[model samples]
Target: MVGQRQFDERRTLDRAREVFWLKGYGATSMQDLASASGVLRGSLYNAYRDKETLFLRVFDDYAEQFLADAAQALAQPVVDQALRAFFDFTITSMTTGVPTRGCLTTKTAIDTKADGERIRAALRDLLDKMERLVHERLSTGEARSRLAIPPAEAARVLITMTRGIVVMERVYQDPERLRATAAALIDALLTPVDPGRRSQTG
Candidate 1:
């Protein structure tokens, strides 16, 4: 019954995201969004038309923030450090929330209906954006032994491993093990120029 200006749109959308993230797109209902968002069901429908459309809005919001975080992680001075920061961010983000907490794009990609083309397209766009971010970082002239692979290929490998780590975090729920694996992956992939000593992030 509240007026549009009276309602907190961002707050409502954030709550809506929580519901979708927890219950998933298939299982969640508009009423669920209303309850979680503290907005009337009618108001929500009026604004977003349908759950698919509403989810698109919420997912886009999430993607913006997610990409911003990834960009920050990849902003470290050293390439290896930047890569480690990215993995650390991923591990902390995926593992901190409740048991069902995982990558939203990843979870949605797996769970959304086959006919959900719009959602699928959004997911693909987000993945491509992430790969581009990594590629930009990898293309930088950070010193010390870097990957033999091309920046584009290395970015793909990093993104693929990141998704795999998301799956691992969901299944294993072991943080230390995941960190160790990240370290090993980094060691295997990034070689030190000096060989004897490693270059630290500045």
Candidate 2:
């Protein structure tokens, strides 16, 4: 019985996540969650107390999955391969789904109508985790002389590019173009930096 309940909860959260992604926090309601998840409205209220609380739970679930995916992508022995894996995951997330729903965190960050401090806090926590994960990977790569860019600088560039990619994905909705852009950016960043040459400093 306990196992079944746990499975049901996860199923509900997955459906809830889809609804919330399709319709922002402001628009989604208990009825929306209930209908999408096929769970009783009273059951949802009893489990999560309120819509905000339920959304937070769903958001946390997303955070966990996102972090795990990042960690997996960065686990490759070669830095280049690791980065490619990460970007491939990112691009897949952006391009997948029926209509392609960009990114949850990026959309949440830009949502001006999204109320409450808790939502902002959740976004911050997830973003911080991502920043740390990317930075750690880059730092390790730099130490091993696998990357020419400084970890701190490269982390900032990569994170910023991630946000930009999210935006561009929505605007262009072209998987090929997005992949091409990411490839070009990776090539530029990975180019060897000659310190002795008096041309230009990176």
Candidate 3:
């Protein structure tokens, strides 16, 4: 029987997620994880195989939480309000959040090595999912009426703009600036386009 004193996998993964989110994969050593997780290095290795494995697990958890939050925001009755909530969340995450390590996926991608390709790919996939969610939310006639571009193209633009905002906030450390940028981006998204022009293309 498993002893009560035995460490919980879920708990350990949660702790590791915080640690990695606070520190990038390369910056976080096994010793740091051991200390943060309250588990010995040998035990961590035994449970997770290696640092990479542990990092991947943590990444998965982060991605899951991100997607869940975005989905909740998208559930709002007004699509524009939902999109604003999404941007607000992004700004809040950048200015606050426990890790302060910037976006994990972007950070990892910038410094990826041969072995880190899989991690990069996972991050890309998550972004793709987000883009799709945005596209679906914007595809409705009411939402499309407020958009300057097609639903698919507008989704892509919003994703890119939001990612850029996050990156800028990380470097600038200015909450007001970030908020202004977010507002501008949302305004651009909410600007009405000509239905006649859209019909011409159709």
| Cα-based lDDT for every prediction | 0.83, 0.81, 0.78
Over the full model, what C-alpha lDDT does candidate 1 score relative to the true structure?
A: 0.83
Model 3: clashing residue pairs?
Answer: none
**With candidate 2 superimposed using the best TM-score fit, by how many Å does residue 44's alpha carbon deviate from the native?**
1.8
- Considering TM-score, which of the candidate structures 2 and 3 is the better prediction for this target? 3
Taking all chains together, the TM-score of candidate 3 against the true structure is 0.86
lDDT of 2 at 22: 74
On lDDT, the candidate that comes out on top is 1
Best by TM-score: 1
The alpha-carbon lDDT assigned to residue 163 of candidate 2 equals 81
- C-alpha TM-score for every candidate: 0.89, 0.85, 0.86
* Weakest 10 consecutive residues of candidate 3 by summed lDDT: 109-118
TM-score of 2: 0.85
Error of 3 at 95 (Å): 2.0
- TM-score leaderboard ranking: 1, 3, 2
Evaluated against the true structure, the overall lDDT of model 3 is: 0.78
lDDT of 1 by residue, 4-75 (tens): 545788998899988888778888899999999888998888888999999999999999999999999999
Model 2 global lDDT (CA atoms, 0 to 1)? 0.81
